[model samples]
Target: MLFEDKYEIIRKIGSGSTSDVFLVRDRKLKKRWAAKIIGIYSGGGTDCRVKQDAAREIQILTQLDTPGAVKIIDVFEDSRRICILTDYIHGISLLAYIHKYGPVFEQTAAKWLLQLCGTLDYLHNMMPPVIFCDLKPENIMLKDDGKLTLIDFGAAYQQHSDVSPGIWKGTIGYAAPELCHGTAVPDIRADIYGLGVLGYFLISGLEPKQVEKLKDYSGHRIVSRKLDRILSGCLSENPGKRYKNCEHMAVRLRQFLRKADF
Candidate 1:
């Protein structure tokens, strides 16, 4: 508070490999915020990797500036640390909801998937195009009003070329086949693949490993040949086989819906 911003800590909410997230309250404006603090050094030497990650995340979030994504409130960076303050999501993460309520109904999953499509579309359409390398269920927060917000941009990268070996990586089951190999620069299709995994999880409570073993959706409440076909396209090992863009996926998903509303 002496040299940095004016936010009082409420509690420590979450943490990641590079940062510690805290629930904080803005002193002047009296608003709630989530502050992610990353130490600039380890063992008395500057941790350039950590610092770059923290700085890049801040840059990405600032550029995003959209309603579907979490909004940034303030930031404080110094020789010792970098603190990023963002609007507190104040909602249950999709992963937590799934653990508590089990799988959702078919239409419910479709609705959320549609929302996700729009969000990803926004990201992929950015100037350099932002690719969310870590887009598992935990990073998606579900608000009380049924809206979904994408959170955590630590593993996100600008999509101009394939990622260099040590730049960024992703979750195993949720990440695409090419992404895990550390060569191919991931594209929007990678997020599409993740979206497919999420939709499967929401409708059938299946993980990626389980999805690979599945052929039919008979046992699950969400039974449809069209859905099976669509998900299969999304999970394709070859990115070229996936939907050209999120809009196409959203259109196909809407067609599979039993009701006209979407």
Candidate 2:
């Protein structure tokens, strides 16, 4: 189908519960775009809610103009689907890269972490502070130019003034422990915990549980002790014990990079 009077659907690329993404080409502009088609349901039901959520993701992404974030060009809705057109990214997802390359080198991982830290800090320091509920490697992509872009803002939300307890939104392995309790609100600290999990996976080639299973290492013998310590601190089960915010975490990571000559 036609979208925005320019983008013509070539084929489906990817999909999620809320939307289906298609690879499209702009006939007039002669550019490629990933068009996310969200289903629209009437009668104010679950489908309607899904559309709302999809729209919210687009809204949140549009507001974030950071280099580390994906670039969205426009959004459109027909009777069947709500389409979000974004710049086509040409690189493998971080998850695919790790599986293929078998974890990243120390310096490479540090560089990636720093980029993500900067991105998260930018999001957290905003007036409303965008909370990215999904921060796993699967949600991150490595551009062909070796740059990083945080994708899938479906779970992003702005902080509310009420400050009341709320249900958590994040993945299991990478999600903060406080989130599992269902009483915590999404905040910058949650991102810190997720980053820690990401660090462990990227540097040690092991997940948090695997790192735990390495009881033989005594926590101090792991490769890159400095990095391990940072990851362990960031992945703390206690939210209060994690980094105060993305800014603090970035500072620590920056220091480590400089010391390690990354």
Candidate 3:
């Protein structure tokens, strides 16, 4: 389907279970944007839960106004689908970058992790606290300016002490063990666990089977013991053993960067 008269669809960029993303250009503004079309209905009838999820995503996107996050441009809804337009990041996914360039340098990885930590801290400190359950490499885009932007808020949830535990919605390898067990309530620590996995991936170009089983980086001459300790702390199986919050983890990462002269 076509968007407004001003926007022209260029090509399909990505697709998921609920949405299809297209690279669209605005003739009037001469700018490119990512248009996500979310199907809200099935053959039988409208899917109320999907509709609510789309609305919730829009609400969360509107509240976010940070360089670390993708900015929402416009949102449109028709009888069949909901369309969300956002900035088209002019770069490749972190996953692609890693595949092309091999594992990132320690300094570069530290810089990116610091940025991610700050971004997570911002989300965790929001009014109701936003938990970004999905933080895998695919969801991270690296721009030409050397900045990283987090995308896809479909699995994000507002932290509410009153709310009961819900179904876990996150990437398998990157997801926290607590999420898989369904025994503990998810919170900011879940995101911390994701960050730890991301760090391990960036440094070693290998995905750990589980956060708790993260390989000892000391054996790798390139990995610093201090950095490994930080990653291990974040990857703790028990949430209580991890950093109290994203801010705390960010602080620790910054300290490591400074010590390493990054």
Task: After superposing candidate 2 on the true structure, give the runs of residues whose Cα lies further than 4 Å from its correct spot.
Answer: 1-5, 42-46, 161-169, 207-211, 214-222
What is the lDDT of every predicted structure here? 0.82, 0.78, 0.84
Model 2 TM: 0.88
Candidate 1 lDDT over 1-262, as tens digits, reads 5423588888998887767889988788888888888888889788988887777788899997777899887788887789888879868998999999998876788889999899999999999999887878888999988899988888888887435754565788898888887657778988988888888888777776787545555654353566767777788888999998899999987887754354
Worst 10 residues of 1 by lDDT: 214-223
What lDDT is obtained when candidate 1 is compared to the true structure? 0.82
User: For model 2, how does the per-residue alpha-carbon lDDT over 1-262 read when each residue is reduced to its tens digit?
Assistant: 4575677788987777656788899898788888878788655544665666777678777788888998889888766777888878889888889888886777788789889989999999888888887788878989999999987787777776333454444677887777767678778888888898887788666766676753245454445777777777787777889888877877877898898883
What is the TM-score (0 to 1) of candidate 3?
0.91
| Pairs in steric clash, model 1 | 162-185
lDDT (Cα) of model 3: 0.84
Hey, what RMSD does candidate 2 come out at? Answer: 3.0
**TM-score for each of the candidates:** 0.91, 0.88, 0.91
